[model samples]
Target chain A: MATKLLSRYPWATSPFVIGAPMRVMSGPALAVAVSRAGGLGFIGPGLKTTDTGVDLEEASSLIDKARASSFKTLSSSSLLPVGVGFQLWSDDLSTAMGTIEKYKPCAVWLFAPKEGQKDLDEWSRRIRAVSPETQIWIQIGSLGEAKSILQSSEKPDVVVVQGTESGGHGRMADGMGIMTLFPEVADTLASSHIPLLAAGGIADGRGVAAALCLGASGVVMGTRFLASSEARISRGYQNEVVRASDGATNTTRTLLYNHLRGTYGWPPEYSPRTIINKSFIEHRAGTPFEELKKRHDEAAKSGDSGWGPDGRLATYAGASIGLIHNVSDAERIVRDVRNDASRRIQGLAAA
Target chain B: MATKLLSRYPWATSPFVIGAPMRVMSGPALAVAVSRAGGLGFIGPGLKTTDTGVDLEEASSLIDKARASSFKTLSSSSLLPVGVGFQLWSDDLSTAMGTIEKYKPCAVWLFAPKEGQKDLDEWSRRIRAVSPETQIWIQIGSLGEAKSILQSSEKPDVVVVQGTESGGHGRMADGMGIMTLFPEVADTLASSHIPLLAAGGIADGRGVAAALCLGASGVVMGTRFLASSEARISRGYQNEVVRASDGATNTTRTLLYNHLRGTYGWPPEYSPRTIINKSFIEHRAGTPFEELKKRHDEAAKSGDSGWGPDGRLATYAGASIGLIHNVSDAERIVRDVRNDASRRIQGLAAA
Candidate 1:
């Protein structure tokens, strides 16, 4: 399974690291940099369906530049090395398929379907039809979801088992930690020949090594990339990500930020984990939503200042934030994690 | 640190496994069996403080019998090979200390102090005074709790970082997954010389391998031990532990079962994760606690049938229940997990 997964991306190395497509934050620069550094990078879901096409166009240009430069090892396959993610329930299938038809990203990460596997089956079928070479990577949070996928007409080429510690939107009430969740999902889908990737609460090489021990062919990191230099984020939000510690207390799974930002209608079963700020604090302390919304709007107009402990903007992140101490380029992050994981794996073996 | 931890218990092997001292369930037979299997075990807190002394006396007899049999590897340290646990907030310290002084257990596992680290400091100091050879093992659920321990006057010889997915009592709100929590706590207390053990949702070899990769010197199993043939558990309760699946939905952290069992006044920060039963279902579905408690009392008189999907007895188990298929003796369970974990660790290193 590990060899099969690595075969899809020739430039990638072992203990495969992935820069998760973290909504708007994961963009062309980060994706291209990660792939150039022998790791897979994914462009997260954009604000609009057509925005994906724009990111792919930028990614194509970046890859072309990298090929002409030092990164001559970059794959020249018909499908681009970078992948793209979509929020199935909110994203328009036709528009996403159109983008995939054009760029033909190596993988399509499908998540948060309103009708679960049935909805995933439709999107998987459509996306595969549009881009035959592209792999379908479905993200599931629970074992039940994994079982449901097996019953679907279109099975994912890869299953990313996300634990409850994941950032962005995840299973609100039915999520377990990846430590137990991953191995169970792997055991259940062992015969399927689909490679499993562990996601959520993974910030560094220690997490990467741990994930591999849990039977993950690869590991996906969302929060760690939020601190990457290439992330498309506000200065304050980035600083907050760097400053946060003791994630158990600093981060929470809440939808207040989503509503405060006027972004509504996420699937009911999903909610985003974010760094706590004044907006959520006030809301929980008896401030009305309307009043909080007014304060959020005011905070947003103040530029980079709208993203600290006192800031009202949502700082969607994972519980692994405390482990991230500084910002670095995507390439460095990927290489460091890969090297650290290798060292740790070797060290544990010797011990 | 791993070497130091193993040196303290010469009978234990690398990737050390410990049977968690589950309340009443982890008794003399289970503890002695685990120790005999070359894994450390701790007798769980008893119904009363005096009951601990009774369990220890039985454990002494079991060790004597085992030594006369095939288990010649057993240590002859003045302290017993098996450890003992106590719930600080509710337990009488003088009584527990007296028991420890008599048995001289290899370790003392302390948990749920009413005043946090201060309470732990007092217990550690007193336990050390009573039995100097007994190692102090402190269980913490969050990074904040880990940080607080560093400031205490009495330092623990080992710290068990318990994630929220643990069965029995755990942090109600602040607990994060062990995948993230263990590494951060390890990084914070790197120079303390304390061996950090990963707990919560750990059942088999994959979990054990993962914890070792996360820098855990050892791994602890609480819920998994509940299914051991030697456990002091009812047949129905053991059946429920094996029957449960999709722990994300089947298990929850709630105090309803505790309150119904007439076990109250647990510190506000903690709650036990139990298999969902008729008692919890009705309570969540608007059934009054008074009516539920009445039904619970009647169900307790019906023998082992008091546990299951419809049973009202508290089935305190971790989210890893789905992975457990059957009951085995503590020795077999320990040997299987240890051997499997070693195999997986070696396999991952080669990969």
Candidate 2:
């Protein structure tokens, strides 16, 4: 079953490394770079549904340019090497389906559905109808969600089992860590033929190797990509991710950041993990939401300076940030992780 | 460092499995059974500090009986094969020190210190003074704790980096998953000679292999041992643990059970993860603590019937309870996990 899943992505290597779609930060440049380095990369949800078409067009242009330069990264000419992700709750399906049909990306990663598997089934069926060759990927944080997928009308080609340590949006209260979550999900879906991918707190080769040992066919990295050079992010935010240490103390899963950014309506069960800053500190210190919002808006106008321990802007990241020390390109990050995982696995066997 | 750590326990195999001291549930039989199967086992903290002495005396008698037979688990005459754990916040240090002086256990696993490393340092110094052959093992759930150990007056022989998925008393809010926590702690204490062990949500061989891949010299299992036939646990509790399939939905980290059981004074930063039952559900559903406590006390007299979804007793366990399907003897459990981890690591290398 795992081999069949890997065969679908011919360009990728063993213990596949995936660049998780982290909102707008994971754009065409980052996604293409990861894919080019023998890993799968998916463009994250955009500011607007139509924005996806713009990014896919740019991704297509970049792939064409690479092919023209004899890069030979992607062998399949008919399919775009990169994938695109969507937040099923807020994203427009028609726009996503239209964009998928036009670009024919290799995959469509779906997450945060409002109506659970029902929404996922609708999106998965429509995406397959529009882009027959594109595989469907669904992200789930709980075992119950994995079970629901089995009963759905349309099954996903791959399931991403994210843990509570994941950054950005994740299960609010009931999420289990990947150490237990992935294996349970894998055990339940052992006969389903849907390859399981581990996500959450995977920032380096150690995490990559650990996920593989947990029976993950592959691993996905979201926060690690946020520090990549190709990420569509402000310098301040990247710096915070690099500078941050002790994520258990520095980061938290809260909706205060979302509210401060004027973004709301995420499912009640979902919350984003971010590096705590002045806004959160003040909010917890009894500062009213309105006052914190005013400060956050003021910080947003300060550009890169808005992100830091003292900065008020939200810096979404995973608990693995402490492991990420320096900023590297997406391709190097992928290669380094893959090589490290191989070395660790071999070292254990030798031991 | 890892080799030196393993050499201390010559009878143990690679990927050493430690039966976590699970608050009176892990007794002499379970610890000795695990040790007999080439793994280290720890007696959990008892109802009183002096109770640990009683358990240690029993463990000493059990070891003597094994020694009288053909069993050759512990080659070292000076060091007892089994280990003992203590809750520093409540366990009287004098009583524990006296027990260690008399038994000279192979290791001492210390956790939930109210004064953090200060208490640990005191325990380490006194333990060394009393029994220099015994190793000091400190349990930490965050990187900060790992860092703090570096500055302590006495260093630990082994550091157990436990994730939030751990049951019993763990870091309530700042604890991270072992996937990220272990690696980060390993990176920070790279220069320190303390061998690191991964704990939390680790029920089987998959978790053992995953922990080793994440740079752990060994792994610890608390919740899994709860289902072991040798564990000092009630049949109903073991059945509930085996019956539970989804830790994310079936278990939670809360103080409701603690208060209901009339067990208080756990440090504010620590909480136990337990399988939810009628008492917890009632507390969450607006039933006052007093009312819940009354029902819990009433249910306690029902023996094994006091556990399960409808019962009111606390089923203290990690999130890995879902992965444990059966109650096996401790010796068989240890051997199976060690063999499985070896197979998994080899499988990854082959892949």
Candidate 3:
């Protein structure tokens, strides 16, 4: 059902490159830019407010503005529809459903549900009832979770296989790499006809090409887009991403950063990957959480500079930070990755 | 220097796929088959005797037997020169050097040295002094190691970047995945002109394609080849490799298996990935080490049947085991992966 819905989009002409719904980083402008570039773009879950709902009024206006911009060269059919992501565990279902109904996004990404597969099933059913055209995409990190989803009645149109290398909230302790996880999930769901999207540590054309080879119909990239111009990121965070050389040493999966930033309420089974900053350093050095939190609050006052080597804030990023060398536009990232993958594939085929 | 040496081989015509020198599984027969199939084959470190040096006489005879077989279709030049691997810390250096000097293999892979970078530098210099034609390939799992190698006066011809997902011995606690690690190492050594080979979780065409996109000149696969007919793996181990589906849950990095199997004295930094059998289950369930060892010995007496779900033994494999559905020939594994990668590349390019 989800695969059938995805076929209606313009991804047939080009490989699907998704601008991942990365918390505060993925915003309306980023989504629109990516969609206009012939790839699916998703507004992150951070946009959904607890009291009101998904800021659909703001999102609708932003989408309109993006459509009205210099993207006139894009065919009406070629203009891919935008997607919105929601954290099922933290979100209010009724509010989220209302927002989806109001905006009618092309797709909805469901992640980190509070009540497991049943919650996801209910969410999928509700979304389908409200907007039958809105494709349901579910993100999973383990084979067990994938199996559960496969058995569930609320089958997703697309399954985003997230590896442990991904940034921001993922399977904490028992996560596998995308290289193995993606193919495993692909093989498990081979008979189900559900398209798979490879996520985690993919930052360039090579990653996109590899994901495709692994049987993913598309790729959902977060860290790569975090360095993009349209992403709602602070300069310090973006610069750190560009300057980071070794993702293995620079990035670590920990909740210490989350605690210092006061962003609690995440489930126990999940942890976010972050560039090791001063706060992380101090925390690892055995500083108390209360002290670190106080220092983090003070550091946050410095605005952009609060996220450098010496700063005390979290620079949430995947190990792929080493692959990113610059902060470019979202369109360029998508186009370059697609073109480079094409060139490589062509070269190999010819060889 | 390594790049120049590799160029002399026939890897340029196709994706450079290598049968990794897995400790016990990679034998002369497997190496010859992979080489005959147009991929570099390596005789693993297991051939190195602690006292007598590498059993070069046996290896030589095996190589001769392989050459005398139906591999006449392979041109002498296309028959990639077989490489020999050594665990520097465990093997007698002088005796191993004698074997390399006599055999003069195409490449020598050095891993787990006692004195770190300086030791590797000395080993490379010695290998070159004896056989200037033989290339030095150093395997590293982290960027720190890569940087150290780059800074060393004695440089290697090829750098094998082994991710945490690889089977056998690899970085234990602090390791990065290949998707991010390979690119970072590539960029760091971009100007050095050293060729990079990606290892770990690379099972098929997509893995090969992805590694190339990430700037790898080739890929060294271990676990995938474990399912190859020519590999010197036991029937039980091979069967487990074929039967395993969820590698993330089925395999783990632990010294318990090594201890039970009585294969100790490994460097503190390295740990092998193994499939969870009865031994692992009992160990994890808080069974005492002595009791588990006693049970493992009893199970080993049963031969092949002692390695299944209820068996008390280690099944060494990578997370990519989910991709292997059969135990075929080494030549087929190499050729199929190359062809598949080519096909996927072509399809993506056309798309």
What TM-score did chain B of candidate 3 earn? 0.93
For model 2, residues A1-351, the per-residue Cα lDDT tens digits are: 557777888888877999998899999999999988889989999999999999999999988887777657586546899999999999999988889999999999999999999999999999999989999999999988988988877999999999989999999877888999999999888878789999999999999999998988899999999889999999999999999989899999999999988898998989999999999999899999998988889989999999999899989999999999999999999999999999999999998
In model 1, pairs of residues that clash are none
lDDT (Cα, tens digit) per residue for candidate 3, span B83-160 = 878888887778777878877777789998877898899899998988888889999998888889879999998899
Cα displacement (angstroms), candidate 3, residue A217, comes to 1.2
Q: Give the per-prediction TM-score of chain B.
A: 0.98, 0.98, 0.93
TM-scores, one per candidate = 0.99, 0.98, 0.93
RMSD to the true structure for each prediction, in A, is: 1.0, 1.2, 2.8
Q: Write the per-residue lDDT of candidate 2 for residues B123-209, one digit (tens) a residue.
A: 999999999989999998887788799898799989999998888879987898888888899999999877999999999999999
TM-score ranking from best to worst?
Answer: 1, 2, 3
* Residue pairs in collision within model 3: A2-A157, A89-A114, B2-B157
Docking class of 2: high
Give the per-residue lDDT of model 1 (tens digit) for B165-237: 8999999889988888889899898878789999998999989988988999999998888889999999999
Which segments of model 2 are wrong by more than 4 Å?
none
Q: Which candidate ranks first by DockQ, i.e. highest?
A: 2
DockQ of each: 0.82, 0.86, 0.66
Q: Which ten residues in a row have the lowest lDDT in candidate 2 chain A?
A: A69-78
